[model samples]
Target: MRGDSLFGDLVRAHRRRLGMTQEELADRAGVSVRSIGKWEAGQVAAPRIGTLRALADAFTLTGDARDEFLTSSALDDITPAQLPLDPPVFTGRERELAQLSASGDGTIIRVVSGTAGVGKTTLAVRWAHRVRHRFPDGQLYVNLRGFGPTGPPLPPGDALRGLLDGLGVPPQRVPADVEARAALYRSALAGRRLLILLDNAADAEQVRPLLPGAPGCVVVVTSRDRLAGLAVTDGAQLLLLDVLGTDAARSLLARRIGADRVRAEPRAADEIATACAGLPLALAIVAARAAAHPAFTLAAVAAELRTSRLDVLAGPDPAADARAVFSWSYRKLRPAAARLFRLLGLHPGVASIDALASIAALPPDRVRALLAELVQANLVDEPQPGRFACHDLLRAYARDLSDRLDSPSSRREAVVRLLDHYLHTALAADRLLKPHRGLGPRRPATHAPGVTPTPLADSDDAMTWFGAEHPILPAVADLAEESGLHTYVWWLAWAVLTYHERRWDRRDWIRWQMRAVAAAERARDPHFQAVSHYNVGYALCELGDLAPAHGHLNTALAFYEKLGNLAGMAKVHLNLGIIARRRTDYTRAIDEAETALALYRKDSDPVGEARATNNIGWCYLTMGDYTRALDHCRRAVAVHEAAGNHMGAGHSWDSVGTAHLRLGNPTEAAACYRRSLAAFRSERDRQYEAIALAHLGDAEEAAGRPRAAHEAWHRSLAIFTEIDHPDAGEVRAKLASREVPPFSLRQQIDRRP
Candidate 1:
């Protein structure tokens, strides 16, 4: 702000003219009010590129006004590398990849269409990653969810919003109406050299609005449908991605299992490829099956394929034969492995080895051996180490097998065990993560035989466990709701609340909590209902959907009042304070926080009282009452530290540091921030660690230690980048403003900052 007086002046003037408080601007711009205050007060050298864009949109700045505001702050939008993780074992698509590479110039659309599970999306993603460097501006991607199990195809409007978001358009700047949003989207990408990969498109219509009107961007659309309209109207190059040829199919097997294994049984390999119908999905499963049983000759696998129900792998639909191929592998499994495989079908998404162990009523080591057998048969895929995922088709096949073979009572027992495993393990992990939060009393010897909940070592292990198991939690909760395990539903939701909040997975947070409410209603448990509603409300409030959030919170409050649940009422008041704080109503925030504090005291809940105290400190800090902020935050930190709640202490430490920094005590602030950073790192909370590092950088800079500040910011930037956080842009801007490039910490600090 010292170098950019005009930018600060304009921002302040614009805010005043619009009758906007700093908080209102921050909310609209998706930034913290602290940042807005600094930007307007000229305490910051320049706003981040993302912040500049957000401000422009918040003020509805257009034409020269937008350009002037942007350029004045050196607003250069960062390239968005949004492609998903590359296929770990992509193989046998050289010809298709070459064709895609040679198809058209960078200005054209390419449609890659194939049958289901025939690797259409895989090919598209693989190719996108391959040619990513050609489009220097950025590579963007979106899964349309067409023909996938998760949900329906993504609406064009939502897809466009995703693209615009990736392009760094502020949410406020994105038009409410789809047509306007599409226009804005096109405008944003007009001349950028970018790659847009639209995976699993339902049809041409779903993709049309997302396409850039101008031609510097190349659009790659993958689908089961041909999307002939795109080819007909948009002149999109149609690359009909058929099943892999014989050699490629065998090569895929070799890549997954081993070349020597395939080489030893060349005819068996060719027979296995033929049995798989040249479909990569089938081939992978078959290869996995083969690899798991390395001692089993390829001829044995081929023999099993020949002896299976299907007379031939050839069929009208490739997926149908792939199911047969799946069955062939399934039939060859031992009773335990086969049972484990079919039971896994009950899991909607990924399953950890522990979950599998519980589901099968087996010990972890026994389950691991069974999984190896299944994996060797290619019946399941270990996408990540210790985490298994069956192909969608294979999952359906397994479910079908379970339905036909397993008795109704047995299936129910397995499901109950699985639910018990997830619920109890989730509770344990949450206990480690948020020690201040009250957990249900452990029930002794309740779980069925062979059902063991995974034990985490500490908060760090809790985070790792949560990270691996997040995707499966919702599905488990859904299973609970379906099976009338009503208590499990709400408790499971409660268990993941901390993890979801830390990860900022708002969508799943809201979805799971809402489902919890429904399950509670079915059970007619007032306490469970109130808690679930409160969770939903809290999640919605975080998402900034204030009206509905208020509605849910009010409902939760009413339930708590009726039930005379003092502790529950206190938690509700705490969240109400948060809602009020988000609206810039500091007085109301403090009032609600005090109400929560009193209720917690009445309930004899010191942890809850500490939380309320910390919340009050945060509100005071936001209101610029730094002295009060310091006092309250210091008390909260003491309480948290005494309770051994490092996560809570880390957050309180940050507030303490912020208060110190605002009071011009940079040296003290740096110490507090270092403590905050250490606590978060110990808890393995990457997001908060980054936030502490950023604050530490500010303190170090203010303390006249530029090298330390740069190092702090560099580490902060690394975490933000790894997590794909929006704040990374801001951190980058902070470093750039200080003429510190984000090189290796050693290299950058070795040179003078």
Candidate 2:
């Protein structure tokens, strides 16, 4: 008979001999009738170890027959000559297994722990298989069903009874008392070298009674937790199983699906491994699917798996079978912990402790304790220090539970409070960092005090805050849009804009500007919309995209005119002048700048007037009118100084220095550059500092001081490199043409001056 027909014949013959129908076997095994039929008919050739054990129990198959059936099922297609197995093909766990195994001799109770699908069971099975020969008596295996939907874990007394019966103790002879049964179990394995494998043991209490006290025996326990109590109390060796190495995952794939197939589809195989995230259970499921369907390419399977993680995780197994594994773990969580786990799925991104606390509105310390419980249950993952994220599959499961457990209004309120927390904190930071950029009228604050609505102390604190929170900002923006919280979206967008501008992040500038514009449009707020359009246009001009810049700027100008906002109109015209200067339309640039300057003077907006005057100087410089440029730049500098704006003063002085350089006045240019550097440093603007340094280098060279010029150029280059500026390449080119002085020489210049 063929392999399938032979397996079917054996299953049928075994069932009939045991006087059990397929339905009876299915009921006893806690599986479906169809699944049992498929197994008997060989349509589904391999049953899980759990199903096989249930069948064996129902059949009353004991002694050699039971052992032979289990051993054959475990062997699968391997020949009798290779029946013992070589190291059981362990992957991603050499060091851990070796360390655990080397923890002295005797009946070492080693516990392997990790999050779900992290290969805890695989390591235990592999380690047990390696030392099986050392235990000459026999090897015993049991799935405690610790994390499944069926119920609580199999009681220690029951597991002990199975082990006793497996070692030849008849059911009638088994003791009813738990302690007596445990004692009997220890006696059964006395002086025998038996290797006991307890897969998915719930806790130390469940496992302690089952351990054989005989010095020659060894026991391996696998669980989805650290089992710290077991280590502290029982001195059990503990091995924390992490994700597999990339190469080992590839090797696992190659083993199941031919090496040639893996090589032919290397990229897809890599993607499959990454999608599985080095989890053994996931990889095994994926590889098994690939093996069972020879016609389905690995890429096709990988693509499908990426779209639906839970669906792929279920694999060819029935939903019931997959839930059996997950529900067991879920059942073990406390009521509050389980609720928190489901609610956490509502979080928009990787969860921080504060954000989680804010969403739950619980004390930080209390929420942290609950998170620990969920972590212990393996329902959540604490991947890095103070950061927690759930697997995509687990997150989806949690989301489903959230919907089932929480009211719609409760979920909405939780999400709203989270958004409010982020918005209020961002506003606070914005106020502290850019106090001059007035955010018209303040909205009524609704968030509570524990949320801590305050900004950091300095620029460094601001940078750190933005950097740490950057990953979640976009998701927060998305949530704001979804929740129809238009004001929150636009204001948050505006606040983040300053950080992006300070860092010269063109991509983020464009992204947030677009979001701000959309939010403004949704709110029908014309003034805010005009501001968004203007800033976005300015960014486009900076990026050298002129046509779109002109279009957006013109749209913004029209909006400002309609709203009769003269300040907004003047700012738009000034930006337009800058754009025209970049396009080399000096005449149009001069015209726009002059008009903006006149309007700013009329409004008595000194800051606006100074900015417009600086633009006028820039236009003249582009047109090769050095005298005219110098006159406007000087006026702009005086106006900026009178306004007490150090940043504006620095820009004006830099322009003045450039005009002096063009006019061949090295001494005047150097003086202007020195003054500009002082202002730029005071403002903490590195970009301007680099420009001033470069100007100083040009003036020094003009004064016939090559060594001093080289020192200045090298200093500027270092600044460029430190800031990751695009101009670093240009600075490098300049450095390569000259014998640059050491940076140490420039550092000592202040002492000499």
Candidate 3:
């Protein structure tokens, strides 16, 4: 960073360290928030160095820090004013905006390039417009008209004339010679804080002359080419723009078409975005079409685009036509690359090189070369090494083309190979996640000649694989079910449920669980249907959707009883016991837990017995039967330890802590709570950690340390808020009541008796 801005940087850093917002820091410094923003933006103003000294004093800098602070802020740097109007449909470049903004520490030269109509110019213009106040000196804009099809791209010499003109140099004084103009332009921008946006450049050579040879000036260049030369020579940060995400795309459509109209057809909005591949250019054209025909339903547009994507995305302007924009890049690809791009449409999820290799019937090395060519052309993106996917629109375009270019049998064969790859890989990962399962292992599919399963070496690999593949699971399931692969459908959902269920991701759990239940019903397997109900019921119960949970659980119980499945019956009873405990029906809870425990013992399953014992001990703790709760909880802990269930043991330790607290043994209770907290933390179980923290606070208060108790409650409250835990309200209430006395109704001690 330039020394002139160091003080501003330091002040901003320290303010952030103190977790103060700009307004709060401004208040402390006895200045307007606008002043603080200007200072941080490296803007020079009239207030002189005293305003900066006030800022340093507010931040409480001392010694060398104070000396550095005063030195950095004392240098008054001119701000530039060089941005233009913003595009109407600007949305979702938050990450790129931050990157571009922070690149100001040194020479701020950023090159934004993507396929045509990817909103490269829109992003650059919007960002520059927003940061206008930072550049008080001046803002200069010059469009080179590269790829505009409006004559040829503007020459470098002519571009310099436009820039020099914006800098207010007299037209006759501007040199006719390109090299002389470049030197003059450099001299003009020297020591002046300026923002230079060289838009739609044909190439690096076109943009190279316009760059200011000054530290204070920022240059943003947009182009269709990657402009590798600029990055290699001038050290420009290259930001490759991709299609907007689904939510952002929906929001973009809503902006052009009325929000009320979009909301009325919310599904159509999402469908349109999907069909548009979240490309801003395509969405804008579709929105414009919708606007032109106010009576046309968005669903009709979505349906039309689904079959004729490239056709519907067309407009009067070549740039507004999504297909035309994509074709510009697509036409640049080699035959092999173009063929591979077309083949990707047949694959359901993102394709790994090996999967693509099998689908294309090519060698891995050969496939990599083809994919690299497509990547360079920006027609395809390799999000990770050896894994390739295209934006939604690109994929649709490819699919539509492939349906004609490739034989139907060939596409069907490619899909099967892709399906086989996922199904086998999922089963392998599921085995590592849960080696022992209620259901038997999924039998390996008879692979096609070239298809291979994804190999997961261990549990960690399996988990990483699961995380990477989870987003693709829903799509994979749909493909599997549509292909009449019912076993694969149910198995895929069941496997993912096992991996994620314990993590308590209620949304994904509920979604996939429903899919699994449907798949199981289609399979006409009684055991599978009952087990699917059990899985979903458990998830719903955890989510506090008790009404549905009760019906699912009861359905599972009846099936298990009819099927004479002792283990399933015992598990259902244990879950029922938990529901009873939630309602504080301790007597019924104990009865249900006892029945589960007896069945578990009869079945010789220590894990099931341990789970039941823990539930019963939890009930005793709730009833304030401290002595019995502690006894049962200790036994539960030992059994859980024997069964090697750390999470189960953690819950028991927590119950033991609560029992000790109620029995007036605060120190012991605190120690047990600490142990439980540590166990949950190691497991990364925030839900249980919050509960442990709340109980720990109770023990802290019992030990006469109200301050420590307050901290514990606050810590618990934050986690509860993060997880949207049901106990959040209670914790918030406790924190609020910490400084107040509350009315209490309690039974008087009858000492006379």
Candidate 4:
């Protein structure tokens, strides 16, 4: 029979001999009747010492009856040899333990948190054992299973029963109401210096009831998550555990298998230690296996562990087996927590709290609380502050669980929800960055399976979401492609491109554009493919990679031409002209610009015609054909103004000013420059405004107003510097010349003549 069962049988025999009913016996012992049944039936062998004591007192037993009960409850048979109390002494944990121990006499709640097998539980147990003597009344230990391979977590009521029984309360006496029972338990230990060890606690809610009221008692909890709520609400001291050091693992091995055996097979032992990945439980199991078998070499054990550590560790003793330990914890979680754990494993990369909230479609605060529960169970690790990650092994297990528990449709829906969240967020950011651009036709809202779309309050909220989620956008794009979310892939690419261009993230621009192009092709949509190619070409041109830009643009033009899309073809031509102008090939620039203008006019696309006209003006200005440039730029401005394209009007005004400045018409140039600056300022385009300011300064200088010119130049230079423009170098040069001593009026005239 199991040790628990044997002990239960012994309790039953004593209770029967005393002629006391289970309830009456439980009432005197201060425990639940169910506990009495389990104990008597030998189903639960290890009734706590206090519970056994309560049973003894209830029976009013004396002499041999009490001795037999005490002996039967003793864990001597279950305790293997030395009991592995030190459990492969952890290295580099002195500082952590010291911090935990020194957290003070007030309800000292320290959480040793880490990924599964990262030694959170071992560290917590080690620390508890070390500090056990500090609490003179005795120490209490309970495992509030948070995560495992089994079913849901044991209810709080069940945990309270165990705790009350451990504290010498008989089965029937323990209250069914968890809160009342906990309150009574706390009141019982009010003035005592008890050390409570709540191991693998599921959350603050689970641990809250078990907390003793005595200021002298210390509570040390261990988990795999941050448990921020516990610290925030309960003032619990948070100590996040990490992996054991190589040296510590080596020492642990040396101590377990003997210094000579380890030294002789140092490499093998090191490998075994490394395979454990600094998980003390894993290390202890391997060491114990080796210790039990003297003939088995460390090298042999190491090889076996490397081949299948999980299988090897899934032994009968849950405490010594990583998988068993995890399973035990898993068996004790709520159904919601178990489902959440599995779903989270389906995430392709590290998910932010908000993303998780959106995926679960739970209230943000509630989702956060659930995540905290997972952390406490030692199933998740908070590697960085506010970010949780599972071990790679645990992640694999979670994924397996997800596959088994969730249907393909459900999994697909979850993925779609995550993708849509990113896509919508990116779209909002795009609108915020380029408010003037006509937003594309909205796709019909298709609710993800099991998920509803969250409404964004405003552009500001959207922008904030985008900013926070920007780091993970690339991963989302990759996931979209992998998941065959073609439309989402391209649209997300387009949305993020707006922010990337605004921020001048050239690398990301290229990356997303390539992804978008592939997605567009998969979608087999000509319009989207054309747009993707055009944007890719644009980004390439920005990076000075004209060959690739030409290739992409030429391909895009052919597609448009085949479709008889004159407007689209015209836009491509206009872009080609801009590229040619950048390359200083003015003739080619003019040709492309003229072709675009003719096509736009034929198509009667006003926006296309205005853009083509602007390109023509820029080409002529670069070619020193100032008169033609001025005429084209003025016409472009009129077209754009009529179309209500304020940004386009700003560009045309700047071009017209440049043409006038080159033609030595300062009065006309100043008027155009001021108009350009006003438009740019109104649009909040600081970079363009700075360029206009510089041109205005030049026009003032040419008009023979030296003091006015100086002021304008200074203002322009300041704007350039504020915007961190590359052209600030030239602005500074002009400013330096202005600061030089001026020639007299007669000398100035002579020099000019």
Candidate 5:
């Protein structure tokens, strides 16, 4: 009466009934006493079928006793199913499992390839159990122990020995040579219709000798290596696995904890998936931890796993440990590729090939070749062309190795090189976008040639480049501050400001620029500090935070005065004028604009001078002084045209249109607004284009051209709403208030003609 007791306990219970010691059982079963003791204590499972039968015979057991022995020994039948019990919460891979069962596809072999912990072995076994009936003869599974905490991989001959035993071949009759055994294995499997799964093989060679050379049997091989040789030579169908998608990953966790609990706390489950990076093994571990403590919430589990990831992911079993699984693949890498793998986790996230080269301190071409090796090994992904990123769990593992393998100075230098790469390269791109921008001092002496950015063709290319790099820049600056590369902290932030302004990302501009100011204070660089505050203040003003915006701009003016930076003073003064105008303090706005104009003229900077003059006109138009607004705006336009600043000239023209409308000259107003819209379009400034359209509607309304007014206002409303601009509300109100016009503008004008 073994009941549900552990197999070892049942063996010990039955053995003592017959007065047998560990020594007596070992001698009778032809196994070591150590194996008997280990099994009884649950350190290992029962011995093989042969040993089990011997022990049964040695006991002289009757029917019930013999049946209990075979059942408890995991050898009730001859066909071995060493496939581990799959987790209860198994999910995803629906597509991959389907391909395995498509009988007519003629794919006898399927190589499930991916990085470590991607669930290759789990997939193979799950598919095998599903399709086991097709192979009525039997199913077979082996770990191969190809990449593990164990010593070398199981040899082909050893694997064949195990396969032959499972096929019911006698140990004494099994052939000694690997070739002969493989031949015998195939002969035994022939016409029988069986399934074999080789889990975690090192390469195709380890897999090939084990594949049954028969039509009916489907052989599945799982490995971290791509195993291209098998596909080429053995006609194996390769199934490359990737991490689970977001929804699938969450569903897997839901199935682990009760679906009710998971649905009630979806965020907690999402956090778990994010922390595990969609790896089934890590998710399973977290689920196991939760199941062990039924009262524990998933949030509590996530927080624990987040703090001590590797430690929590490591269970008692070596195969279950994420770190051990990673180490197996890492140890397989060549020296140079391994070094890059460890150092790459030091970077924030995805990066360009040149950026990685900069961190590695190697030439770009050499570094790219090394990276290709990692790509082939499935350790890293080229998610986008020229950009490489490791899986999140792998990144954490790499960080752990980085702390161990790389020296402190080496790690610090690598990060420094990375920061410098973004700083100098972004500055180069920004300058290309705005040719009037200043080029900073000669590139840092520490810069390797790999720090170079992609060569930008024009402003269009610059826009695409900035869009990709925007997320990385602030992170690079933060890394600089954390690593105490104080110089890079402010300088890189200062460099990216030009892109952020035109890109109109007010949040990132303000956040990163403020960090730049703090870093500049640490570096004790007043000029750069002034630049940071100036840029941040402008973004705040745009975002409509008048008070803090005023404070930052005033502080920046003080810094510029101390440095005697005329151009800096002119820029800050011009922005203060803009803020004043936005706040409706037209008098103060004009005064700030006059001071900025004087500074710009003193520095011989015509563009800055024109910008100041334009702001004065804006203030004048707001104050109902049409003649003065016209005079100043006309002067601004003349200077901007001479300087070839089309965008600036366009703004001045828009101001002139407002002035003419205030003077009751609708025809002249409409003419100027048209000029402004064309210029803004040429500059690709959608925000400004929307502004011009809105004002053009106002001018058309003043001219009694109702049809033209409706057209202009509707277009403006669409643009504003699309860009999420605050002015969209006002434009919508205007459109809503308008009545349908009786005639088209063309019809009214045609009647006059």
Candidate 6:
């Protein structure tokens, strides 16, 4: 019966049975009374061998009683290995694993935190198994059940008891009081190199009590909650886990199914990775489905996932169901934050604070607080400072919640506010980008309540804003159209057109403009329809699709002529002239340019006047009328400079250079080209800058400065290649052949009035 007792309990009982005090026992064993006290108190798991021998002499034990005591004491030497089975197929987290391992010199308390089903526990367990040798005393693991399916989070006291048990402290010896138990746990771990893994901890409070005060132990706590308190008070290092990357996600899928199967359907594999939103749990669910149904192609699985992400990601276990798992975290949020989370699903992409505020009808500061809570819960991420994004699966989950909980009218209102935010902000940014090019009436200073557009500092700031927000602009336009904000659609397209044209992505420019054309036709707005058609035509010309470009231009011209919009007609004529020149119809180019110039003069627009004049000068240069070309281009340059239109002036100067080159004045040609290049560089017009550089190279070669010509050509080619311009091929050819083409390359005429 006594053999069943732990060594500490046995020592206490036998000493009392013999009617001896701790001091008397210590004297008999030739040890201090403190040592006897420690054994009886259960603070020390087992006494040393010498101490055991001394205790045996002190107790004067023999036979079964003596053998039982020694046997019980010897059992304490067995190292506790409470770690769960190593993750069967751990993937990714290479950086996280290294972070866990690199928590330098001393007691390490690393908190691995992430969203639900992001594989925090797997990463912790995998890393624990890897460095288990360093903690030779033992490795202890406990799941605190923070966001589990069953009960509320495990209490700190209960978690402490479980950890103590794993450390081999008997139930009777473990203290009932949490603080006392914590002391006993730390005492048990003192001087031992152990790895304590507190998995699924609810918060810092749940994990703090279980940490050993001793220096030799390493504690890893994983949770969905950020556990900021633990990091702040306990000096714990945090490793915030994100979803798996493309390569790792694919690899995980391959490992579950077969690599050959994955390789066979790489595109489907990519689609699965994207649809899964890189979440390891969702990926695992997909992998399971694909493995279970060998007859199913990866494409079929990927298609299923696209239609119902959360549904396809569901599993037999409720704990693994993405919807269920996400709900656990969602339920913990406060009312306002939970509502914000729901509304975030309405946002198509990364949203700024003002956009969220407008959608939620809350102030920016209040929205920030709610967003912070969401971020702490790992339901939202600040992808960039002041810009929040949700995971795709989470967005799907949030959208589902919004559909069920929020009213249809409320959702529509929120979408309206969201569109208002983007449209107004984009217009303000556009105004800064092109102060002279007003497509329609000016935007009013007033906005709807709770809708605050982002304030841009200057043109550079405007350019920066567009660069960050361009990818989402088209999506916002789509959202606008879906919400029946038809006018917002074309305006959104027009707002971003200036940015698109100045940048090198002609294909995207054409796509957005086409969408605007459709929206304008649906809205039955002829003016915008004409504008949209004209923009599409301009973009098509840039891409060398001249036939379609000409068609769109003529359609725009007819609409403008019908509306009697002289200014609009002027813009169409200018673009038509550029198309004619591209087709080498010099006569038609001059006629169109003359028509545009007359319209600009009638409209009293100086910028359009200069642009039209420049187009005529280029046409004349193309036609070998060098004297008239020189005269027209010089006047165009003067008007452009006076009007403060650097871009127009640059084009005029390039035209002037071409005329001079045709007139056999290489030195003057080079000077005009350099001036043109400077103007393009000043405006950050990279695409035009490349063209100007090419013109400069031609002038330099004509001037018999082959070395300068090559340098200019090299710089031009680099820029063209960088921007993915179609002319990069021609530049490459010029370099390869070590010769400039005959001055047949005309400067690009202005397509915008």
TM-score preference between candidates 3 and 5, better one? 5
> For residues 30-51, what per-residue lDDT tens digits would candidate 3 score against the true structure?
9888766755664422233566
Off by over 4 Å in 1: 1-333, 380-389, 441-445, 543-545, 718-733, 739-753
Worst 10 residues of 4 by lDDT: 75-84
TM-scores for candidates 1 onward, in order: 0.56, 0.73, 0.63, 0.65, 0.78, 0.86
Which lDDT tens digits does candidate 5 get at residues 1-753?
Answer: 111227677778878988999898888878788767766765543444666777788778779878777765543245555556764456888998888776654438888989888888878878877777777668788778878888988998899888877876656545566776676576566565777888888877888889876677878888888888998999888888999987988888778777887887789899989999998888888888888898998888889878988888998887788998889989988999999999998887888888898888888898899988888688988889989988889989998999998899888878877887777777667666566665546334456434545667766776777788887777777678788788787777767776666655667778778888888789888877787788788878877888898899999999999989898898888989888898888888999999999999999989888889889988988888889989999999999889878788889999999999999998899999999998777655667888999999999999998778899999988878776788989989988898965876878788694
Q: lDDT value for candidate 1?
A: 0.81
Model 2, 1-753: lDDT tens per residue? 112434456667887887888887777768788766755654434443455677777777899988876656531321111112343456567788777678466677888877777777667777776666766677887778666555678999899877765776545445577776776577566666777888888877888899886687777788876677888977788777777778988988888788998999999999898887777777878887888899999899899877976567774344223334565677678887887787788777787777777777777778799999877766777876666777655676777778878999877777776777777777666655455564655553567544533347865566667767878888888887788888788888888876776566768879999988898898998988898898889878866778888888998999999988788789889988888888788888989998898888888888888889999998888889999999999999998888777778888998999999999999899999999998877545566688789889889888877777877888988887876767778767877887645547665776485
For residue 29, model 6's alpha carbon misses the true position, in angstroms, by: 12
Per-residue lDDT tens digits of candidate 1, residues 367-467? 89988766544456677899887655566667778998999999999998898888888888887887767654532237777788998888778888888
Model 5 TM-score (2 dp): 0.78
Model 2's TM-score against the true structure: 0.73
* lDDT, residue 625, candidate 1: 93
- Candidate 5 clash pair list: none
lDDT agreement with native, every candidate: 0.81, 0.76, 0.79, 0.73, 0.81, 0.86
* Stretches > 4 Å off in candidate 6: 1-78, 89-99, 228-235, 254-270, 287-300, 442-446, 664-667, 701-708, 733-753
lDDT tens digits by residue: candidate 4, 498-604? 56654446677799899889988999998788888988987887667888999899888988887788877887888798888888988898899889989988987
Q: Which ten contiguous residues of candidate 5 have the minimum total lDDT?
A: 442-451
- Candidate 6 per-residue lDDT, tens place, 204-238, comes to 87788888886999999999989988879988999
Overall local distance difference test of candidate 4: 0.73
Which residue window of length 10 is worst by lDDT in model 3? 743-752
TM-score, model 4 to reference? 0.65
The local lDDT score (0 to 100) that residue 225 gets in candidate 4 is 50
Give the candidate order by descending TM-score.
6, 5, 2, 4, 3, 1
The lowest-lDDT stretch of 10 consecutive residues in candidate 1 is 309-318
lDDT of 6 at 121: 90
Go through the candidates in order and give the C-alpha RMSD of each one to the true structure: 32.1, 14.3, 17.5, 11.2, 12.9, 6.4
